[model samples]
Target: MRSPASLVLLALPFTLAVPAPAAGNLGSATTQNGLTAGGCKAMTVIFARGTTEQGNVGSLSGPPWFAAMSKAVGAQNLAVQGVDYPADIPGFLAGGDKKGSAKMAQLVMQAMTACPDTAVVMGGYSQGAQLVHNAAAMLPADMAAKVSSAVLFGDPMNGKPVAGVPAGKTKVICHQGDLICAGTSTILMPHLTYSQNAGEAAQFAATAAGM
Candidate 1:
C-alpha cells in the first residue's frame, strides 16, 4: 500500500527530460474522467493513449475516447481510469528503460490504489496499448493476479510478449485493413483484427462482462 505521494517520489528518478506541464494538469485527464476521492468495485479500467501531437495527456482524443468506449461496454458501474499522459515514438521506443517502465508501473499502481478491491482491466489504443502491455509486465505479482484482462488495440508489443499477463485474459484487437496487422510475422497469437466483422467488438464485450 504505497501512498500516492511516495509513489510519485519513487517515480521521479526514472522520469525523462521531456517537459511536463504544471502540476495542476498532470492528472487533469483523471479529473476530467470524473474520478474523485472514492473507489469502486465493479471493475477498475485504465485507459492509456498513443503518441500525441501535443505530448500531453490532456488532449481531446484521450479522455473522450475512453468515455465512448466506457459507455459502449456498459461499464457505468465500473471505475474507469485514464492515463493520458502522452509519450512520443522516441519515448515509446525508450519504454523498456528503467524510469519509463517505473512511471508506467506507478500509474497502474495508483489506479489500483484508487480502486482497491476491484478487478482491473487495462486497455490502450495504438502506442498507448503498447505501454499498457509493458506495464502489465511490471505489475506486482499480487496486483497482477487482480487484473481481470488486458485489451490491446491497433498496436502490438512487437516481439516482446508479456509473461505475467494472465493467460486466457489477455486479448489483442487490430483493424484488419489497418497495415499494422500485416507486419506481424508471428502466428498462434490471440489476435483479432477489424476484418473479422463485428466479432472483435463481441470478444471485447465478452471479456468486459467476465471482468
Candidate 2:
C-alpha cells in the first residue's frame, strides 16, 4: 500500500499543470509547467478518481489531460489537479474523521481560490468523482458559483447531490459495462456506455466549449 503523500506525489505528475500566477494577483493557479500561453485566461479543472487507484493520466503522453481539454475547448489557459486521498480516507472521514476531510477540503478551496477569475470544472472517476462532489458541496455559495460545470464519471450521486451545482451545467458519464453502474446512486448516465478510450477527454472538451 502506498502512503497517502506518496500516492499524491506519484499522481501529481499526471495531473498537475505548471503553477502559474493568476493574472492581476489572483493567487497562483496550479498547472503543468510550460503549458500556459499568454493572452489566455486560465481555468482550473479538478480531476478526482475512485478507490485511490490512479487513472490513465499518469500513463498518457503529450500535453496534460486538462491542457488538452482546455485547448479543445479553446480556453486561453488551463490547469488540472488531482484530488489525492487514501482509499479508506472517505470511510474513516465519514466515521467522524472530520480532520481528514476538512484538510482535503481546505486544499481544494485553496486551489479554487487561486483562480478566482478562471471558470472551474470538476471531473472525477469512480471514488474520485465522489470526492469532487463532496468538495464542491463544501464550497461557499459565492465560490461555488464560480464553477462553470461539474462532470461526474463512473460514480453516481450516491444520495448526496452536490448543492449549488447548477443542473444545466452539470453532466455525468458512466460506463454501462462497468459493474459500478448498478448502484442506486443518482447520476445522469451517459448517452453511450461501453469504453471510449478518448471519450473522457472528448467529453471534457465539449463540455468546456459549452461553458
The best candidate in terms of TM-score: 1
Please identify model 1 stretches exceeding 4 Å from their true place.
1-38, 53-75, 95-101, 158-160, 181-211
Count of backbone clashes for each model? 3, 10
lDDT of 2: 0.47
For every candidate in turn, the CA RMSD to the true structure comes to 10.8, 9.1
Model 2 misplacement above 4 A = 1-41, 55-70, 74-76, 89-104, 158-160, 184-211
lDDT of each: 0.50, 0.47
